[model samples]
Target: MRIGDYKVSYGADEAVFRTGTVRVWMIVLFLAMAVFPFWAGDYLLYMANLTGIAIVAAVGLNILTGAAGQISLGHAAFVGIGAYTSAILITKLGLPFIICLPLSGLSAALFGVIVGAPSMRMKGLYLCIATLAAQVIFEYLFKNWESLTGGIRGINVPAPTIFGFEFNNEFRFYFITVPVVIIVVTAARNLFRTRVGRAFIAIRDRDFSAQLMGINLFRYKLYAFALSSFLAGVAGCLWVNFIKIVTPEHFPLHESIRYLAMIIVGGLGSVLGSIFGAIFMTIIPEVLKSMLNIVSAFSPDAMAYLSPLQTVVFGLLIVVFLVFEPHGLAEMWRRVKDYFRLWPFEH
Candidate 1:
């Protein structure tokens, strides 16, 4: 296949597993995951759970911001909605966890469509503001809506069960999360190869041009919002299950920023990047916290200030990456692999 001025070989064009090496790496990854629960400690399993949740959320945001070119600053609101919905459904309505999770996703999708209706008349910063407004409204409702949300006190969530088998331990939850993560990531990757996904990309690149080419910008924009919200809602449901609670404080503005950072740091439109971003962001703080603990042991004054220092460091890292490697860690990996493949051909 030829695109523009470049020629793509049959292997290059058709290949997701482009080489034998990649296939082997994938096999290794599967094997590692299969055995992870046996070897990994409780903390590591917890971290993996966090990574899975983040990856799910990041991929959803990527669908909105990267593929659809729609800026959203309130994705966490959808997550909150999903969590609370699931909690209420299970606790109040006596719905099973299995039914509640999907219901939560559907509820979020409905809200997403409502939010996306205005997207036809808005773009860029305006759309961002609209989403931001939604986020604030959701937070206010969660806090003040005492009858349903339980006000600022929040609500407790029960452990998830599948056919009478309870997933209460981190190890059991890890198994649940890993499979869900893989399924979501695979679905997201394949989404871009379909007509709906292509429409999103076309509209994202140039809405006027897409409309001229027979794509309905308004319909597709709404679709993007629905899909993104669905994914966020699923992530939220999983998150509440992991934490065993649904609190207004869990879905804050900072979480929205973290999701944005994950997509940006991972790679805007790449599925692999979303996973990388989630894992990196989730683990980095724990690593830093451990280092801080060691420092605190030696200096109590430094210990007292470690929290602010960690925040500063995290902020600095984000800034540096944005400035120097805007394409993100995924792009960086691509460059290194390309360099190796094209070795001795100094361009």
Candidate 2:
């Protein structure tokens, strides 16, 4: 979209930041992320932490369902696995935060492989049903396994500490979550450019054709699942540490659907779209609540109906976006940029 930008090499053509404007924007973005927590109030910081965690999970989900075209209803279970794994490592084994985080991801990845084994034989709805089964099984274990998960009572998680520096509050935790988010998002963006990434997309488009091209369907599908679950686990770890608790109720079916909605509302098969979808879904509920509170000033009854109304608006948004904008917010964003890139001129 750069009017005067010229690419002189093949590498330049494939570059992410194709122009000086994009590089400048990237720097400004990093600077903004660094500064936001410092000036934000407590409520804002809490919301920021939630949004950051959600973003990580959403992006991870995108790698599986969006890029790989796999269907899953067990994503929340994977997050739970990560949360519990990190909790156990911290409380039982007395591990440090640095060691626990990556191990949590590894644990989720292992579980992801187990859940994905069904994919070797089933696909589409059948595969989804299999994941649903996995979800139920995970829930059962979380609730009944008294020794590990603490049964129905749930486990109280301690805040993450690195080298004795505790992430005790929202602002301090911001340092942990935000930087991890940036690294994860960047890694995911780069993944799509590599052979493994392209293989996932190929299998997503048509596994038979991908297999014809000598791609191993089982291995790559497992890879997709593991990578996606790893990201989910990281997000789960962040959530457990932030809220300082681990519970079976924390990761639910609706949470899986919510992450699916994120990819659907953002844009399938797009990394930037994943982020856009995450921010959109995370912000909408708050916006609805804020509006309802304003209306409650004149009508006290509005307070009683606020929660349901928010749900209604949320559903309406998904339906509207699907019917009217199937390409999701990412497409809309691109159109806006395209229009402005040319400014008052038509080519």
Candidate 3:
């Protein structure tokens, strides 16, 4: 009775996985993911954890910059705030990891609201500069506040323990990272189906029109910041606990730029794009290093010639994506799926 993938209801039309084939593939993907940690080596697991954390942060940036059209250059500051909050709570107040996790997000959300206040009056590059100022301020605080942040020596964190089990290794922590990524992706994907998420898109498209439609531009803008920073904070907390350390040097301005690039290269405003972007950004460097090692095995001085080009190559790739496929990796992926789905057809 249901033929040719046509939907009879809005719910069906708005479904994240629109077809049975897509749902089956998603199940298969999750099953493969569940099996990955069991077979993956330590280094691969470590990279997986890093990619997971990056996914969380990139998704957040996409929510603000991609979906909401608000640019920020201080996302790294919010991330640092969360890292410090979790570190202080654990080392000083003796809070458990379970308790500190949400607290880290809340703490960052507070600062996000404060920093996002300028978005009410500022737009585009002006707003970007305002966020940049925040980055400088927070970085100064993180560095100079020796009493709290340990003056660049940083703080060490113990592995997270839950229910008498310690997530003390890459293998154990993979479980934690995977679940959080799943929840974050699911929530973000569903978010755009709601009124507030629509409002964000509206504001991103045309704020004056959105305002005329009774949407409070300022309030929604702050909401975007708060939500974005909250996710970044969660990523930060996971980052500190996973690495067993927190430092001022970790969340630098360049780190913020890297995140912006993730959303851009992954396809702005797309949840699946965020994941692809994070994975590509985090893993491609390692892949390049591996290739360099292979070349170095053949020629001892290969690194001397190839090392500097890694960055150039990476930048060039981004440029290519921007010029050829401004929609990012997600669009490329969708096209591939479409090609297969319509194989042997002549239109």
**Model 2 TM-score (2 dp):** 0.98
Q: Which stretches of candidate 3 lie over 4 Å from their true place?
A: 1-3, 305-307
Error of 2 at 339 (Å): 0.8
**Superior candidate under TM-score, 1 versus 2:** 2
Off by over 4 Å in 2: none
- Global lDDT scores for all candidate models: 0.87, 0.90, 0.92
Worst 10 residues of 2 by lDDT: 338-347
lDDT of 1 at 108: 89
Looking at model 3, residue 347 earns an lDDT score of 39
Ranking by lDDT: 3, 2, 1
Among all windows of 10 consecutive residues in model 1, the one with the lowest summed lDDT is 1-10
How many clashes in candidate 2? 0
* Backbone clash count, each prediction separately: 0, 0, 0
